[model samples]
Target: MRWAPPGFGGKRRSPEEIKREGWREQKVLVVSETDPRLTWPERELVRQLGDKLYGYRKEARHGRLDP
Candidate 1:
């Protein structure tokens, strides 16, 4: 799976479009540590990536690096 920053693809849809497509809004960021398809090394990589993204997101939101 690929991850991208929110709203990169296009503008917001109208209510009619949303209903027609059955779109649902939810939290955007997700880190899964238990994906069975990932090999041991890949899982480790994902964990590290998740850590980095989380830290960066925290810093961006709070204007300071995580301790």
Candidate 2:
């Protein structure tokens, strides 16, 4: 079962809950390999959000949230 790292904001989410929510494997790429157009703040936001963003993406893909 998967679990969110401790201190994730919002209601606590267990790994099993995340899987049920349709979270999938994600490949991590070096920042330079990511979109060159992304600004520093955008990159920082992505770093800060991390897996939470993945969860959001999963939720969106599953229709749990509006795109």
Candidate 3:
């Protein structure tokens, strides 16, 4: 099951909506210094999907989802 936004009345949502939901999750992947494996396109995809991206090892140390 999933929680939809206030205005989502349809049976399904677009990938952007699903990705946006993933960004709202309580956990996520955090990288340090930007992984070389993440190509420009891949990075852009993540950026488009996520609320924000951080590069702080300190934050990662705490957890990927910590505010």
Please name the candidate that would achieve the greatest lDDT relative to the true structure.
1
Error of 3 at 57 (Å): 16
lDDT (0 to 1) per candidate:
0.62, 0.55, 0.58
Candidate 1 lDDT over residue span 5-60, tens digit each: 99876577886565545534542434356678678888888767876756444434
Candidate 3, residues 43-65, lDDT tens digits: the string is: 76665445345443454446456
- At residue 44, candidate 1 shows an lDDT of 83
Residue pairs with backbone overlap in model 3: none
Comparing 1 and 2 by TM-score, which wins?
Answer: 1
lDDT (Cα, tens digit) per residue for candidate 2, span 1-67? 6677768755878755655455345433434214567888887676547545444545335645543
Candidate 2 or 1, higher lDDT: 1
Q: List the candidate 2 regions with Cα displacement exceeding 4 Å.
A: 1-33, 51-67
State, as a TM-score between 0 and 1, how close model 1 is to the true structure: 0.35
In what order do the candidates fall by TM-score, top score first? Answer: 1, 3, 2
